[model samples]
Each structure stands twice: as structure tokens, then as C-alpha cells.
Target chain A: MAKQYEFRIKGLPYLLVLPQMVIVFIFFFWPSAQAIWQSFFLQDPFGGQYIFVGLENYRVLFTDESSAYAQSFWVSVVFAVSVTVLAMSLSLFLAVQANKKIRAASFYKTMMIWPYAVATLIAGVLWLFMFNPNVGVVAWFLKHKLGYEWQYLLNTGQALTLLILAASWRQMSYNFVFFLAGLQSVPADFIEAAAIDGAGPARRFWKIIFPILSPTSFYLLVMNLVYGFFETFPIVHQVTAGGPGKSTAILVYKVWRDGVVNLDLGSSSAQSVILMLMVIGLTVVQFRFIERRVNY
Target chain B: MKRFSLLMLALLLCASTVFAQIQIDWWHAMTGKNAAALEELTKRFNDSQTAYKVVPVYKGSYSDTMNAGIAAFRAKQAPHIIQVYEVGTATMMNAGGAVYPAYKLMKDAGEKFDPKAYIPTITGYYSTSKGEMLSLPFNSSTAVMYYNKDAFRKAGLDPEKPPVTWPEFFETAKKLKASGMEGGFSTNWISWIQLENFSAWHNQSFGTKNNGFDGLDTKLVFNTPLTLKHLQTIYDLSKDKTFIYGGRENKANPLFTSGTVGMHFESIGGYGNFKNTCKFDFGVARLPYYSDVKDAPQNTIIGGASLWVFNGKPKEDYKGVAKFFTFLSQPESQAYWHQTTGYLPITVAAYELTKKQGFYDTNPGPEVAIKQLLNKAPTGNSRGIRFGNFNIIREIEDQTWEDILAGKISVKDGLDKMVNDGNAELRKFERLYKK
Candidate 1:
């Protein structure tokens, strides 16, 4: 009778969460574990054979002089971090501006979010045409209006600029939505009190508004960084193709290339495991060092 | 009461089984006009046969179809037949028991499946050394040059005569650009047409052992000076704006058809689209070559895709597939397909049948691709690439071209990188087979 009581008390939470737990284990956690397991093996694309090589794939990924693996990994980090910061900052600025009782603020807010409605694939296609060397409107402006002999598609720096712009454009809208919601929830009495203390717009923003928006910024940064690596794949593949000599080859694209394009599941899995480790290590570092600086 | 209920259920099952038709589902990547043609063909086959019903479903693109098939196979829910692109041959061949060879399927169905019936150059590429035909040929095509006759005439060049060699082609391209054409010369499938097909047409090995046909241990051999020089030619043209670099693959076709480009080198499948579009006068010709090489020009290889039957299909359904293939290979059907679409006739008899019907005379550019392909038997290099992971190799080539076009890397350096990286992919594929 005592054991039954213990079992009933202990197993109640597990019983309640069983269905969700099973789904998470089967679909998410299982694939991740298998990916880690596959990282230790080498797979042949043609014959579908697997050979255990004990971190050889990782070794190739980390230290290979000629492979694009290391380059893509570093690029992904830079891309993710830069896009996250830029998007968060821009969204915060726009959200603060729109929070006021200015005329037509709703109209401005609505227009800012229009880019989020466009699918990444469709956006990529539109960007390709917009950057076309011969017929693109941007090309015409660069050559004729600005008198600059510039092409965006083939230039690495310009290509990256466009990619970040497109990525940040969508992300800024999402961040704006979140930050606006967070800003609205910040209790209007606090903002009114700060303004009564002879604080300027800049001071109020830095002292009161921004401090409260820190949590929202942190959340948006994490989500945007993850999207930059994973969700950005369709746009990158469709537009740049990691071209101009692999200037924009990100980590997740490398995983997709290795797995789907090359059919080397082992190498792809190794890339995935490495990417996971990198994201985790990065998150931990940020929490340890940067979280302390948060005003909240 | 329970026994009676179970007996009734069994009887109901038996009754339904008596009149039920064996359904075969096919997944293909053909869309637009070609999709319509395929639907018509399948509908005709379904009407002709009562034993089995063949259903054709349009999957998105070539890569999408291949990925879907791979995922389905992993889930044990694959369709009966899948139309795999030419580049995916290696992946499909390496699938082992997941696929059923057409030879085996036909034999099991007590149907006559002859490898000799197909064009040697086309069939040999997809067949094993044992001469087993693994897949049935569907929409076979080859690369050809599409020229804007109006642009040529405006440039003071003959609208009827196309350049025969690389030097002549380049010279004409310069002339076309000098004539103040907005876009001079562009190409689709830059990697496929320029690198892969360039190597084939020049009889140069893209990889060792005739592009990995002999074994998986094949290495990339596309870094030779000849290949580098050819790549440099295009790269130099891009720098000069004489050659307009379009998107990576299949992205330049619309530009050509829309009259933005004076000349375009693309797969012959563009015939239907170009015919429909292109308000300007246009002509098609054989792909140009480098005159310096010995026996420089050769018949170009096929593009498009093939229909591969899967393992899980029934014997009766295989009979239906065979019958459909035979019907597809008929002279009238082949002529209609060739005349209407840009794909080449797969069978020699159908080709001759098309010629006898004077379809070529009525439509000038339609016959140019077939004539280019059948002009000579494909040699070792010109036949086709059979290496595993070839699609990735093409991806590497695409990036290399981008690098060259962007002036980020020298032509020689780009080709060297392509060879090195492509060889790594080949080695990876080879290890799979050896194991």
C-alpha cells in the first residue's frame, strides 16, 4: 500500500506528459542522438555503406586545410551574430519610435511588417531579379543614377550585404512585434514618471525603456541567430549558392550540401553535431559573460 | 455470433478483391507542357490496359523528386516508378535493393526487354558492364546553341550560319556585342554546358577512367591546360561584358527566350519554350568546339531524365510499364513528342520515322539537336559520366564558374580547385561502392 502511494504520486506528472515526451523523444531527441552517433562514422554516398572511423569526420571538419567546412562554420557564426545584433538594434529603434502617440504610427508599423508575409523562397527570387546585372532596377540605379560600375550578385561583399539586409529585414519585423508587445507591457506609469523627472528622449530610452526591453532583445537575439543558421538556408541556396568562391557558405548549408546533395550522411551528421556543439557553446558563453551586463 | 461476423468480414474482403484493380503510382518531375504530354501519355496507357492502372503524379523539381524518393524508400513507402534526372543516375544506381532493374522487371513479367534496342550512347551510360538496363529512357535531351537570328543579322553576320569553332564563336560574340546589343551571349546550365559538356564535346576526360565509368576509384582530371584555357575564355568574356553570366543553372534560359541575350547555349529541351516565346528570329545549331584538339567535336550526351521502376511493384504492373514504354517508343508517338517538345527521340527507328515524316523541314531547329547527337557514336569521354555523387560535382563546378566570373579566382585556380574538391567527392563515392 505504501509503494502504490509512492508510485501514484511520482508517476502522475510522467503520465500527464507522456504523449508530449514520447513525441519529443521520437522526433527531436532521437534524430539528434542519431546525428551525434553518425558523426563518428564515415558514409559512402554511392553504396550507402557506413564505416566507423572514430572522429575522423570531425577531424576533417576541424583541421582540413583544403575543405570548405571550417570556412563555412566561421562564416555562419559571423553571419548569425551580426544579423542578430543588427536586427535587434533596428527593431528596438523602430519599436521605440512607433510606441509614441505620433500620427499614423499604426500605418508605419503595418508597413514595417509587410516583408514578414513574403516567403523566403519568393523573397529570394525577387532579390535575384532585383540584383540582376543587366535588367535589375538596382543595377540601373547603380550604373546610371549613381555612376558606379558595380554589380551586386557576383561581388562577395555586396552579396553578403544583400543577404544580411534581406535576412534582417524579415527578422526586424519579428523583433519589432515582440519588442512592441514587451514595450506595451512595461507599465505606462513608469515611462510617465521618468519623463516627469526632466529626462530627455535619449535619456528615457537608455534609462527606462531600453532596460526593460533587455529580456525581449535577448529572446529575439537567440531566435534570430538560430534562424540565421537554419531558416536562412532556403534563401542562401536560392540566391547566392555560397558562391563568389564560397564567401557565404554557412554551417547549415554545408550540412545540407553534405547530406542531401552529396548523400554523405555521416559527414552531414558530423556537421550537424559540430553545429549543435557550436551553438550550445556560444549560448553558454553569452549567458556567462553578456547576461551579467543586462540592465534588468 | 462472433464466428459468423468474422466469416462475413472475410467474404466481404474476398468480394472486394475480385474486381479491384492493381494501381501503380508514378512520381515524376515533368511540369508545364511536358507535364501535359506525360498526363496524356499515361491516360492513353490507362485506357489501353485494364489489368493495371498507371497513375502519374507531378513532383516539384528534379532534386525534389530524388529527395522524395530517397525519403520514401527510407520510410518503405516508395512509389512504383520514379522519374530520376540524368545527374541522379549514380545515386539511383547505388540504391542497391531499393531499386528494381528494368531488365529484371521485364524478365519477371515475361516481357522482351532488350538493351540493344536503345541508342548505345544513351543506354550504355545507364547500363552496367553486364549490360543490364536499369531504367527506361524518358525525356532524353542534349545541349545545343540557340541564336537570335535578328541579332546576328543586325551584327552583320549570317543569320543562317552559326559559328563552328570556339574561336569563331568568340569572335562572333564580340561582333554581336560591338553591334550594341544590350546582352550579347548568355548560357544556361553554365556548369553543365560549359564544364561537363565542354569536356565531353572535346573528348577530354572530366574525371579518370572515362568519368568514373570503370570504377569508383576515379579521380577528377578536369584541371588540364586545355580545360583551363576554355574556362578562361568564358571568364575573359564575362570580364569584357561580351559574355553575360546568368544565374547558376537553368536561370539563363528565360533571358535568351525573352530576347535579352543574342545567343544562348542550353539543353535542347528549351525548344518548346523558345518556340513559344522568342518574338525575334532564332536558330539552333550544334555546340561549338575547339579546333586545336584532335577529333575535337563529338556527339553531346543526353540531359533530362529516365523512368526507373521500383522494387515493390507487382508483375502485372511491370507488364503495364513495359507496354507503356513500347507504346512511347512508337514512331508516331516519338515524332509527335520530338516535333512538339525539345526532347530527342530515344530510339533510332523513331528518329528515322521522324525524318521520313519531314518534321525537321517544317521545324528547322527541332532536328538540329538530334542530328548533333546522332552524327557520331559517343566515345569514352563523350558518352556520359557514371560516377556517384555527380550532382555534387556539378555543384562544385557551378561555384567554380561563379568564382571565375566574379574575378575572385583565376581560371586555372578555379579549375584546379574544382578538380581537387571534385576528386574528394569521387573518392567518397568510390569508398561506398568498394565497401
Candidate 2:
């Protein structure tokens, strides 16, 4: 009952994928392999020489007596989870509002998507300007009108909160686009039938629209986690610099600070490998468990 | 058409000839106004010579520039020269076969270089224990106290006489606060000013082995009774809102310049920024010391960048580098740079030249930094600190200090943690460099 067709060209498939394969190997796999190799060795800053010290770097990181490594891991988890939840919920809410048959909906959608075009670092700088304790307009208002001394510079909790808000603010636009698309694709007739059956807006959204959007939501959850974990470095760097006493020093920020600023290539590489494993483990769990509930 | 083609060919040939000249690339981390000043100096060097053209490239911040330089060196495309920050000195020095020491390069190139010509506190920082200069000191500054003269006058303190001792400083801060100033005192570079320079300024050892100058096996010893007393003073000050913890590393500069904080401790290099920004007159003074400590008020350490020559460059490029350094060393050029940038004059001759030109008479603040550098002969501890992995050690210090300030840990516990964490980093660095 099966029909097979062959072009009789042995190298065509390979030829067709050669460019992408070459790019992926050169850009991704090669560097990752190099990181794995470098993680096993202690190297000078200038790369003049290297000594293979087999797992010493990992041992030092895990056995750190100061608990900096462990604390950064927890900080990363809190940051990534908070950013994902905050960004996703906010974007979903905005998408739902924009999906309604309201006047100037297209204009609202376009304006909402404008933040996606701004660079991440610029977004961070903008937020910094607004929240800076000394010179920020919002800080001035909080100090003068609201009678609240907003000192993120000294308060670790406040600094972390500011970073989360800034990071999630930048990510909202990206999640909104996906969520809006997902909401649009949900058949309107289902909602109409539910309305006819006396279902309220909240009930319809909870029972019908949310399940229909599960696939997109799951996809976005994974993406937002990765973004929060790895790609929020610029925001941290530009805003808090993982400071106010290392309270905001996330895992990825530590990797950069150690590798680039401190020039400890071995430790940085080991941390990168650890982060890679974490992401792999997370993605596997998501696909195995969360994907089961994602309808289609 | 034939004549037009010939003219175009002539222009192309001329352009190629210009490009053929050895281009000495100098990667630096200067940005904004400083970048423009650096570019002007480079243009002067280029116009002054036809044999070599020194091209300056703006390469992000200090750490970013160092990373880029390291990556480029690995790719075997390193620049001829790089501007390394003061903290990166040890790393650059230990980068075997990757750099040509400034003294050796100058000597081998037969340049008329005199190590003694530079200010001792300035050159001693980038030198070996034997006083051999490892890198050419370009822009150097020492920590000093910056006071708002208007605020001091308003607080009924002598505007001309800044507090010279810790007790006096605290009293003045209280007075400023009593005078209704929002912030009485703050500081930038807490670790650098409070601990490192504080130890050096009191002639107390910050670490063993001459502040890590002699070898890589140095351990941090700044967690002493003296440092504890100073930190306790700051802690008490913070309790009363007299001393505002203005984040870290020049973040407090705005508090001083905005006239909110009456007194601020910052690098003398902040002169230009303060002069440009502060609406009220600001005065520079030597960093305060504990009055009870004998031999207190030793020379403070330098805290700016230097020009390092990398290896694996053409011999001609080395010669160009030597020539450029010679040009920079000229008294006129050094004085000009000092006047413009507010960085200390590297050479004694430059200082004398600047004084002879009556620059200090009109601009009184810069002389304080220069005088602070030349205050006394640098003792063992007063000489700059040079330890491997100092960058990480600095982070540890900052974190510990923050913890102490935030009341998360006791002063002794925080300082003890700093020593432990810093020693571990040093051990790691020693292992890496041992081979």
C-alpha cells in the first residue's frame, strides 16, 4: 500500500543541507564542543598555555564554601520563573484585549509590538533612566509625592524587583506577538457557541480559549524561560550590574563576569556547560510532561 | 578620457602609498569626551610623523577591551598596543610571551627612557618589586577627598581647610547634616578608597609580600583591627544617615556634584568631571587618616590605566610604539594631557613644567592630586597592590563590604569572609600561573 519514489541522486540530499549543516557546525556545535573541552583545563588569560585539570573547575564551583554558586542558581530560578510568569500573563492579557473587535485594534497591536524592535540593552538603559534613584523622574515622584524613598542602590530586594520588571517589560512585546497570533487562530465560532449556551466571558476564556492556546502557551513558556535564563544578561549588566550585594547576580551574569571580566576561562566554561545541561534537562521535562497536555 | 583616467590612477596610487605606511593600531577603552581627547593626541602623533601612523580604536569599557584584546591575541591578530586598566596589570604581566615589557622594549629599542623621571608612586604601581617598570604609565590618579566648598561654608566649616583626620571628617559631616544637607558624606570605590588606599595611606600592609608585588603567593591581610575601626566608624555614620552608601565605583560622584553630599571620597581623576558638572565650587584634599596611627598619611596608590605593548608585532611597529611613548613622555605633551584630562602628570618634569606654566595657580585642584602622589617616598605598603585575580578579589571585597554595610553580617565575619574568598581566588590564580 506504500508508494516510494527516488530521484537516483546520491548527493542531492546532502547537497541540499550542506550550507545549513556547515553553518550549524561552525557557529554552534564547534563552539559548544570547544567550551566542553576548555571546561576541563585551566588556561591563562592570553591562551598561551593550558593544563588539563580534570573536573577541578566543577568541583570548585559546586563546593564553593561561600555558597555564591548555589545562591546564583536560586537567583536564576527565581528570575527566570518570575520573568516568564509575569511576561506571559501580561502579554496574554494584552493579547486578549487586542483580540477583541474594538476600534483601532490594529493600531494598538502595532504600537504594542514596537518594543520588539528596540535593542535589549537600550530597553534596559531606558528603564534605568526612569528608576535611577538620584535623577529618575519616577524616583523623584516617589520621593516627593508618594513619600517613598526608592533606593534600589542599597536595597537588594528592590534592585532584584527592578531588574525583573525591566527584563519582563522587554519580553512582553515578544510574547504578545505570539499570544496574539495564537488567540486569533482560535475559532471564534466556539466562543459564539459557548456564549449562546450561556457561558460568561471569564468562563469561556478559562474553559475554551485557554486550552486552545495551550500549544502556543507551552512553546512560549519554554522560549521565555530560555530568554530569562540566558538572554537577560544585558539588562542585568546595564541596570544593576548584579549588584546591591550580589543579590541579583544570576547564573548567566556570573558566567560572564568570571569569564570575561575576571578572565577565568575554566570556571566560565564549566558554568556554561552546567547551564547547558540545565536547559537540556528543562526542555526534556517540558516536552515529556507539559507537551502531553498541549493539544495539537 | 585618457587624461581623466591617468588622474584617477594617480590618486589611487597616492592613497595606496599612504595606506602602505605601517599602521600601528592602539586599542583603548576611552569613550565620550576622553575618547575625543585621545583621538586628538593620536592625530598629533600621526601628523608629527610620516613613517608610522598610530590609529586609535575605541574598544568598549576596560573589561570589554581586555576581553577583545585577549580574543584577538588568540586569533594572532592582536593590536600593537592596548590600554589596560590598573587591575589588569597582574594578568597582563603574567601573560607569558604575550607582551613585551615596557622597560625592556624601551631599552632594546635604544630609546632614551628614564624610570626615575616618572613620579615614584605612579611608576611604582606598574613596576616589579625591583622597581623595574613593566608598563608605561599613561593616565594615573590617586584617591582623595572631594568637598563641596559652598556646603562647607554653609555648614560653618572652613571652606579652605578640609578635614584631615577621621575625627575631623566625622564632625564636619555631622555639621553638614545639621545644616540641613540631604546627604552629608558618601564615597566611591569603597574597597579601593576605604581598604586598599586606607592601608597604604596608613603605611599598613594590605597584603604580604609587599602588597603582592614580590610574588603571586600573596594573601590578603586587610582585615585588621585598624580596618575594622574604620569600617565601624562608617557603620555608625550610616546608622545616623550621615554617610550615604552611594552604590559603588563613582556612582556617588553625582551625590557630591549635585551638592547633596557635602563631602565625598573619590579618585582625583574625577576632577574634570566635577569641574564640569558641579554648580558650586569643589575642593580636593588628601584622603583622611586615623589621627592616632603613627606614620599615617602615606602616599596613596594610583588608579588609572597604562599603555602595554603586546608581543608578536612587527619590529617596525615596536619602534613606532617606542616613538609614540617618547612623544607622550615629552614634558609639553604630558603637561597638556594632565591639564586636559585632570590625570596626574606622569613625570616629575611634567609636574615642574605645569607648575612653571602657572597652571596650578589658576587651576588649584589638580595640584592636590599631584602633591598627594609626591607627598612622601612610597613605602613597602604604600606602593600599589599587584595580585593575580585581583579583579575577582575586588568583587569579593565589594560583596563583603556590601554585606557588612547592609547589616547582613558582622564586620569581622564579612572581613574574614573576604580574606578567605580572596585567598581561594589567589590560590586558583597561583595554580593557573604556576605552570
Candidate 3:
């Protein structure tokens, strides 16, 4: 600033932001530090004793001959990219339709946003019921009507597709809300001018509207990627349980399975650390490259 | 002044009574009907004594409860008693100073307990290599065959006779499938029923060192010719949809109860749910085994949970725990528990008591699990498996089996993968516990 305006008291600014700092430090930093510290040690499930064996956990993870760790990484990547693209594109389509001045547009918008109210686990269960090979209605239709045996329990591709659809279904509403807000912010005069210049609806959307929505789309891309990576555990757990053969066991789900179910503390903690680094790296890249393309 | 003094004396008497009774916390994972039954039993134990009061707290699922108990132990606020599932037996046993062995708890408290009173197959699972019981067997169950008798009659097979051998079972499944049944046979807990209990029931070694009883340096030996033969048979059956792969762990129960699947393999613990849900007549039979093996159909291994006493509680609380265990061990209480929950009566006296009372005559399927357990003296291979990282091992087995069923891998390859992955987990557990 041209003129420096300082706090009257030495510690006043620190005091003013003390509550948020305390919350962030206690909830986020503390647990992350604990994970980093625990990643270096081998501990029993009871935590009665621990021995520091530096880098062994990480080494085991990277060098695992079964390639389960590496497989889960690729699974996570495929899952995240598929869910983000499907969810964002579908929601954008719906948002564009809802942004029209048609009758009952508000009603359409309200109905489209209803899925956001469902908890992730509940959404997963709902999809699971619909896709259950034994008694699922849709499965029954596919089998009886189409003469196709719908068996996701044994088909890796089918299971992955179900997970992608369920995960995207739950996230679509959130993206729709943001996309609708973004569409509303685009000045109508721009579209009108493009229309007067003899541009068709599709051409007007591509040339005038979509460029202005780049900032919102970029923001959603990052958010959707993170959600797909970390927040799809419930979907995978309830629907496929990372099976027919670990086909859907993403990195985050593996971390939970090892750490919580198997009680392999060091290995799971190492996984957590690696996942944290990957996300950090991803976000940095997104801001560096993708943000440059945003018109805002 | 006289009335005030009388009131004070009454208050003092009440306070003294409350202070004299030791309170013991019992953390359990029983839910729904079983939970209510547990609450009733706890109330009975409390009312039957003036020296102690045991409060039963509902923890989440079995694994969640075990984790919570471990966390509480680390915090030095552990409950006096915890109900740990059978898979967690090795973990609890290796927890060294964190637990007081059940036999020692009883002996130290000067309570009279006879390990011989319990069914040998039931107690053998939770006992040390030296045959010392480490945890009190509670709600024990074993895998068995469940059949829809109505489906059998509809398919023109004898409703009373279930297949006693694997070859016969497969033939019957083919017959049922030919009769237009959608799913002829299915199984829950494929790894438990098809692998662990399958090996034990066939008198085949599941692992070296008597299934990891002697030491932690155990390797899975279930990839034997017999196991491969059986898996290959199942694979062949699956090609025609005669054998449906029900998802893991009791998920197949609904298929059987809904009468969609003709025959099902599940735990005896599923008896209550089937009896209540199935519209058709559901029957229980012993698990099928290969007749070619000389020592085929040995006793099956037990599942379900046991009561483990934790260390680091007051002496008085230990005394209360011993008393609670004594009450649970009584024949009447064990029989009641068995009758109500469809779990096995752990003790011989309870089994005999229930039989004498003609409970088995009226409820025919409840006794099948008991008979399966007491059918023969358990050999080294048939007793039970005690291995580190068994939960993870079970997961790996499930994955491999699914892969095999899905045609992603051959049966031999799947079994080999299971063994290799299981051994690696065992090694990791060995290293961790060595600390």
C-alpha cells in the first residue's frame, strides 16, 4: 500500500485471526502431521508399541510386487476423470436447458437440484438397489426384456460403469447449481447481439456464451476432480466394495481398507501421505495451466 | 428433627448399596434381535446378583467394535469385557499384555471353570496350542448347507434328503437347474465356506504349523489338489449358471430365503433370519465334502464371536467379569441363548439340556450346527485357523475367487495368487507383532 496502515497493538492482527487459525491448525494440520509422523513407524493395531522404521512403509508400497498400489492409482485416475467429465458435461447441459425462459423453468431447476440433498452413502445405496443383479428392477428389465444377463458382481467393466454413473449422478446437482448461476451471470445482450448477427442457437452458445462460462467451468473441473478422487469412497464401498476383483478399489478406498479394516497403520498412513502429495500437485497444475485459459 | 434423621438414614443406606456393587462394562456388537436377547441376559445377570452389575453397551459392527476396543485400551479406558469376532482371535491373542487370558481370569478370580464342559470344536478355536482357553466362546456358529425344501419338492427331488457329498450336490444343482430354477445353488462367505471351513471339513491342512497355531511363520497350504479340484468343479458349474456367485458374506441369504436359489451355503447363525423370512420350508444340512478323501467330513470350524477380558481393570471388576462369565456358562443361560439367537450351545451340558427339553425336536435346524460341531473329534487340520492378518487374507481370497469366477484367471492361478498374497500379509503381520 502507498500508506502503511498497521495494527494499533502488536499482536492484534494475530488475535483477530486467532479463532480460524486455531480451527485449521487443530483439525487439519494436527492430523496431517500425525499421519506424516505415523507413516514412518510400524505400530500394532492396539498402538501399545511402535518402532520407527524410516521409509520402509513407503518403500513397500512403491515396490509391492502384486502391483495393487499402482493398480489402485490408475483406477483412481480413470474413476476421477470419468466422473468429472460425465458429471460436469451432463450438469452443464441441464443448466443450459434450465436457463431458458421457458414455462416452469424454476420447477425444472428445483427438481434438477434435488439430488444434492441426498447423502453420498444413500445415493450409493439407491444405485446399488437399482443395479442388484438378483432383484434389481433395472437388472430384471435388462435380463428379461433385452435377454442380457446383467451381472456386475462378476464383470469389472459393468461394475466400473455402475460406479461411474452413481458417483456422477450424486455430483450432477452440485455442478448444476454452479453452472446455472454462471449462465445467469452471462449478459443477455451478448446473446441477443449474436442472434442479430444471424448466429444460430448452437453457434451463439459456442461463440458468445461458452467463453464467458470458462471461469465457472474451470473452477468446477478442479472441484469435480477432487470430489471424484476422495469423495467417491462411499459409492464404491456400498455398490461394488472394490470388487469383483479389486477392479474398483480406488486409492482412497484402499487407504481405508488397509488402515481401518486390516489395521495396517503404517501402510495406510503412507498411502494417505502419497495421496495428499498427488492432490497438491494436481491443484498446482490446475491453477498454473488451466487457470490461464479462464476469461476472468 | 426425627423425620429428617430417618430420611438421612435411608439416603445413606441407598448410597451404601450402590457403592458396594461393582459396575463392569461389557462392550458388544449384537444388534436387533440378538441385541435384545443380550440385554435380557444382562438384566438377568444383574438381577441374579447383589455384588455386581454388568452394563452392556452396543458397539457398531464386529470390526468396528474391535477397533473401538483397541483404541480404548490405548487410552487406558478399556471396558472390562469385549466381544471380538473369530477373525480377530489372532490379533487379540498377540496383543500380549493388553488382555488377560480367559482361563487365567477365571483361575485368578478363584472361579470354578471346566474347559472340558465346552464343545471341543467350539472351544478349540479360541484355545492356545497347549489347549488353554484364551477367550470365553460366545455365540459360536459353523458353516452349513441351507436348502429350500419347497424348491426341492418342486424339482421332484426328495425334500428330506440333502446331498451329503460334493459330487451329489453338483448333480442335484444340475437337476434343479434343468427343472427351470433360475439359480440352482449359491453360497455366502465364499472364502469362509468354500476355503477355510472347506479345508477343515475335508480334513485338509489350510496352512502349515497346524494353521498358524504353533507360530506366526505360517503359509497357506490350501492350494492342494483337492481344493483345486473343488474350485474347478464350481467353475464348470458356473459356466451354465448352475452355481451362482452370491456376493461375499451373507449376501446370498436373501437369494435362498426368497426361494430364488434352490440350495444355499451359509452360517448356522442365519437360522433365525431364514426361519423368520423364508416362506418355504428351509432345512439345514452339514456342508458337503468330497467322498474320495479318506478322512472326509471332519468337524467344521466355528465362526461368530467370543468374550475377551481386557487387562488393566480393577480387581473388583475382574471379579464381576468372572461372575458374569459364570452366569453365562450355566446350562440354562447357554440354552436360552442358543434357542433365542440360533447360535450354538457352547457347552455339552447346554446341548444335552436343550435336547432333553425336546427343543431340537420342534426346531429341527437349530441342532444341525451343534451336531456338525460334535460329529467327530477335531484333528489338527479341522480344529480352526489362527493366522495374523486373517481379515486381509480373507479379502484377498474373496478377490481371487471373484477373479476366478469371472474368467479373469484360472482356478489354479487364483489360488496361487491367494496363497502368495496371504503369505506376504502374514509376513507383514509377523514383522509388526515381532515388535
* lDDT of candidate 2 over A1-296, digit per residue (tens): 79976758988988989999999999989989989999999999888779999998899889965647988999989999999999999999999999999999999999989988889999889998898886677877987799997888868888889999999988999999999999989898999999999999999999999989988898889999999999999999988888877889999999999899988899899999999898889789788967687656
The fnat of each candidate, in order, is 0.47, 0.65, 0.64
lDDT of each: 0.79, 0.89, 0.91
TM-score of each: 0.91, 0.96, 0.96
Q: What does DockQ give for each predicted structure?
A: 0.47, 0.67, 0.64
Could you arrange the candidates by DockQ from highest to lowest? Answer: 2, 3, 1
Reference contact recovery of candidate 1 = 0.47
Local accuracy of candidate 1 as per-residue lDDT tens digits, A4-110: 33455777878988999999999989999999988887764333567788988888887886567878877877888878888888988888889888999999999
CAPRI-style grade of the A/B interface in model 3: medium
Candidates 1 and 3 compared by DockQ, better number: 3
In candidate 2, chain A reaches a TM of 0.93
DockQ of 2: 0.67
lDDT of 3 by residue, A128-218 (tens): 8888887678987998899987899999999999999999998999999999999999998998988999999999999978988888888
The number of residue pairs in model 1 that clash at the backbone is 0
Tell me the deviation in Å of residue B11 in model 2: 5.3
